[model samples]
Target: MTKAQIRQTYDRIAHWYDLIEAIPEFLGVKILRRELLQRASGKVLEVAAGTGKNLRYYPKTCQITAADMSSAMLEIARSRADGLGLDITFLIMDAEALGLHDQSFDTVVSSLTLCTFPDPVAAILEMARVCRSNGRILLVEHGRSDRERLGRWQDRRAERHAARVGCHWNREPLKIVLKAGLKVIDARRAFFGIFHLIEAMS
Candidate 1:
């Protein structure tokens, strides 16, 4: 999808996104976000920080810069930050082309966002690029399940799902990490191998 389409699609769904998240099916997602964000430290940047779902999980001592392409989404994130009494810097930015400095953050993070980027590799590279040499790139994401039957099901509905939700649910997070040449510090999976929690060094 074109950048405009992506921004527009997410903008339209920004409000509903959190509502859908409230469904019981997504409890695991919240658990994953909390588990990953708990590790964030020092200067942190969260790309595509949709609705600031990871905001409350941030450490009070950490400085956070939350970014996203959709302005509407960022608005929601800003409000969430305010309600949580967290001082966060919010910016509207395209994940593929972040307007941030290189090697500036001590920790770079993104959750459940890679699968939607039109160029997932470029996005991963951007995350790696902004992280300092010793900084970490942490992510908690869901992708194609290891099960063959589910893999086939994802393949069959991938196109339609992407068109509607602006995400490719069947992507392989490990492959994208490898393509980015990130040094894997740790990696694990949950939900029968559908959710990947990866921590890699830049």
Candidate 2:
């Protein structure tokens, strides 16, 4: 789907997005998010911050900015932040071409977003560009499984799955990060190697 189409799709489902993923969030995604975000510090920017799911995981001392391509999704995120009593800046912006200045943030983050981006590498590069030299980029992303059979099953249904939700579930998250030219600090996979927790230096 085109970026505009993806935005519209997300907007249409913004209200239900959290509920739809509740099972997985409860199962393990939430834990991964918390573990990955604890490293964030100083000026932090979360790209594609859908529904602000990561808001409560951040340290209270960090100044946070959350951005997404879909305004409707961002609105929900803003409300979530408000409910959490956390002051956060919310913006409607594309991850591939962020409007923020270069190297303006001490940490950059994104979660479960690479699958849906039209240009995942570009999005990662943008995250790197907005991050300071010594800054860290944290990610919690899901892709193909490590098990051959499960990966094959995902590949077979990848197109259909993407057609429904714009998520290319078969993409490789770690490879995309490397393609973006960031220096990898650490990378770990969980849940049959479908979910990746990656830390990188810009």
Candidate 3:
């Protein structure tokens, strides 16, 4: 989809997105934010930061720039940031084509977001491109199952579900990060191997 179309699609879904995605989404965000906090330091860039769900978990001393493609989602994020008194810069930006300068941030974070990108590989490469050489990039995503049967099921359902909900279920995000030239420093699979926490160095 074009960027405009993607934005509109997400905007239309913004209000209902959190409500419909409450359970696994909440748990996943919680897990990811905790993991990110352990390694996060210095200036951070959070891509596709829908509704700023990860904002509260960030340390008060850290500076954060949160970006999302959808304006509606960002509107909600801005309100949440203001309500929490968290100083954050919110921008309407694309993941594949970040407008920031190279090596701009010490840490890059994406929580359950890679799977929704039309070109996840390019998005990840951009994350690495905008991160300092020693910076860490953390991701928590749901991917294709390791089990043959479940993997096949995800493969069969992913495209249709993606079409309906703007999310992909079968993305191999860990492999994509490695392919983007980041070195994997740590990885853990949870929720019956459906969810993953990956820490990579640029």
Candidate 4:
């Protein structure tokens, strides 16, 4: 989708996105929050930070820059940050083309966001680009199942699903990260095989 279209689509859905995604999304992000604390330090950037779900989980001393393609989503994020007294900067930005300078952040985070990117690989490459040499990238995503039967089902259904929801379900995110020249330092799977938590360093 064009950037404007993507932004408009997400903006239209912003108010209801959290409500509809509450159950699985909330649990999944909570898991990511715990994992992020272990790897994130200093300045951090959260790409596709819809509604700032990770805001409360961030350490108080660490600076956070949360960016999303949709300004509507960032609005909710800003209010939440204000209410919580968290010093997070919310920007309207596309993950595939981050405007930040090189090596701007110590940690880059993407929680349940990779699948929504039209070009996951490019988005990740941008994440790595903005991170310092030794900085880490933390990702939590739900992807195609590893089981043969379910994997085939996901393959068959993913395009249609993506067309409808703006999210792809069958991406191999670990492969994308490694191909982007980041080394995986930690990884975990959950939710009977659909969810993943990956930590990598550039």
Q: Per-residue lDDT for 1-202 in model 1, tens only? A: 7779989988998899888767523747778778888889999999999889889988889999999989998999999999999999988888888888999999999988888899999999999989999998999888998988988899899999998877898999988999889999888888777888899987
Candidate number with greatest lDDT: 2
Sort by lDDT, best first.
2, 1, 3, 4
**Where does candidate 4 have its weakest 10-residue lDDT segment?**
26-35
- Model 2 over residues 1-202: C-alpha lDDT tens digits? 8998899999999999999989778768899999999999999999999999999999889999999989989999988988999999988898999999999999999999999999999999999999999999999999999899999999999999999889999999999999989899999998888888999987
Residue range with the least summed lDDT across 10 consecutive positions in model 2: 21-30
Error of 2 at 158 (Å): 0.4
User: Model 4, 140-191: lDDT tens per residue?
Assistant: 8888877878889999999898887777888877777778878999987777
TM, every model: 0.96, 0.98, 0.94, 0.94
User: How do the residues 1-202 of candidate 3 rate in per-residue lDDT, one tens digit apiece?
Assistant: 5567778888998888778768876656577668666677789999999888888887778799999989999998898999999889998899999999999999998988877888899999999999999998988788897887998999999889888777788988888888888899999887767788999987
Off by over 4 Å in 1: 24-27
Model 3, CA-based lDDT? 0.86
lDDT, candidate 2, at 1:
89
Model 2: runs farther than 4 Å from truth? none
Error of 2 at 130 (Å): 0.4
Question: Backbone clashes per model, in order?
Answer: 0, 0, 0, 0
Q: What local lDDT does model 2 show for residue 4?
A: 86
RMSD of each: 1.3, 0.7, 1.4, 1.4
All candidates in order of TM-score, best leading: 2, 1, 3, 4
